[model samples]
Target: MTGSRKSADALGEAETIALRVLGFIASTEDLFDVFVNASGVSADHVPTLAEDPEFLAAVLDFLLMDDRWVIDFAKAEGIAPEVVMQARAGLPGGDLPNWT
Candidate 1:
């Protein structure tokens, strides 16, 4: 039960990050345009694509590209900087780092 619940929480976190990623993208024309061009996501499809975990993961990955952007988004969204990292771990490529 605990493991399942934790899995649910992780999925929930990914969705939350998805929403914030949309919000962050919509706030900046340049960023939005860049995402659209690179992701091949048409503005018309945003409402649909935003719900996808893979799409959400892509958004997180996009944000992770730049520290300044990540910081800005965290500040605007009122979430801790670490929350983004946590959310990332819920995605396909988001394994915990092996800091040996």
Candidate 2:
């Protein structure tokens, strides 16, 4: 397949996953809080992620690595792309990595 086609396919999958993650988040406050607190991310991040599927999935992956079920749900569903990019971009400013 062409590069653009491949990119589009990947993005479509990411969007599906991101929507699932958002649905899960709305259902589970525990998971939502876990992601927000553990990620050290703000609610403002949501709108950005909603607009960008790939970034959302990346953010969910980041949150899930903590090994908490609450976070795992987000990873399973996938998050939007921009949120992940923004959150990851901000990590270097933190005293310690979020993974820890």
TM-scores of all models? 0.85, 0.52
- In model 2, the runs with Cα more than 4 Å from the true position are 66-100
- lDDT of model number 1: 0.82
Best by TM-score: 1
lDDT of 1 by residue, 1-100 (tens): 6999989887897778867877898787599888888788888998888878878888888887788878888898898877887788897667857364
- Per-residue lDDT value at 11 in model 1: 88
Q: Estimate, for each residue in 3-98, the C-alpha lDDT of model 2 and write its tens digit.
A: 989766756655655556566765676766766776676878776666664456555464445545434563654643344333433332322445
Candidate 1: segments with Cα more than 4 A from true spot:
96-100
Error of 2 at 29 (Å): 3.0
